[model samples]
Target: MIPGVSINEILTLTSILFFIGVYGFITRKNLISILISVELILNTSVINFVVINKYLYPELLQGMLYSIFIIAVAAAETALAVAIIINIYRRTGSVAVRETETMKH
Candidate 1:
């Protein structure tokens, strides 16, 4: 069973996750790692949106709609990025960010 927690705890947890995502975004080099970080950031926003919608504006679907759109966009972004990375690897023979510089001119 989940422990009884307050709003403050939830917010703090979200904040920590957001920071972790930021750190991953800054420190990771692989395309997939950055994509996961982006999704993590989006998850934080979606959680906040749902919480506020449920508590502060119980009569509207705006937040839910926004969250849905964000999720869709994140999915599309990841798919497109992965496709590009695959193409890049097939042509260049490597996915490492540091090695893509040879084609930049």
Candidate 2:
């Protein structure tokens, strides 16, 4: 939509963001960091959906609807995740992935 930007460029950007999110998710040992990584991953997908829909089917609202649904789900998931993390922190006193392993009991 910009003067020179193309869908390919947008998709490439999203792809890079996706991999960065994946890397963060894989290497992060803290619950908060993992949650942030997951959010980043979800955001990239949302962007992809919207961009593809806008470029290929500008007449339809399906992509926009789907993205709205995704955003709602992501919000709910984040709330639940934060609540769980807080509970775990209160119980174990640490949010580190390795340190919270005692929760199995």
Candidate 3:
């Protein structure tokens, strides 16, 4: 697909993206930044599914179905995370990662 691109190249790109997301998730202190990182991580899986299906299983729709499902779940997760982050900000005046621990009290 895409003229001459191979699955190995595509997978390599996804792996890089995934690791960047993981690094962001680990280093970010803001809740919104962490959410963005999580979204990025989820998107790599979606890309992998689509790429694999297009290159290896062109006869089946499983890849498309799985990608769609992942997108829907990611959307729902993003909405919920945003809502929770907003609530936390309203209560604590900060959306920092450490601030969330106060919610346990």
- Each model's backbone clash number: 0, 0, 0
Total backbone clashes of candidate 3, pairs 3 or more residues apart or in separate chains: 0
**Which pairs of residues collide in candidate 2?**
none
lDDT of each: 0.82, 0.95, 0.94
- Name the runs in model 3 displaced over 4 angstroms: 103-105
Model 1, position 66, has a per-residue lDDT of: 92
lDDT by residue for model 3 (1-105), tens: 687899999999999999999999999999999999999999999999999999999999899899999999999999998998889889989988887774564
State the lDDT of candidate 1 residue by residue for 13-99, as single tens digits.
888999999999999888678888988998998887776776668799898899899989989988998999899889888877776
Q: Which sections of candidate 2 miss by over 4 Å?
A: 103-105
Rank by lDDT, descending?
2, 3, 1
Model 2's alpha-carbon lDDT is: 0.95
Better of 2 and 3 by TM-score: 2
- Which of the numbered candidates is closest to the native, going by highest TM-score? 2
Candidate 1 achieves a global lDDT of 0.82
Which model, 2 or 3, shows the larger lDDT?
2
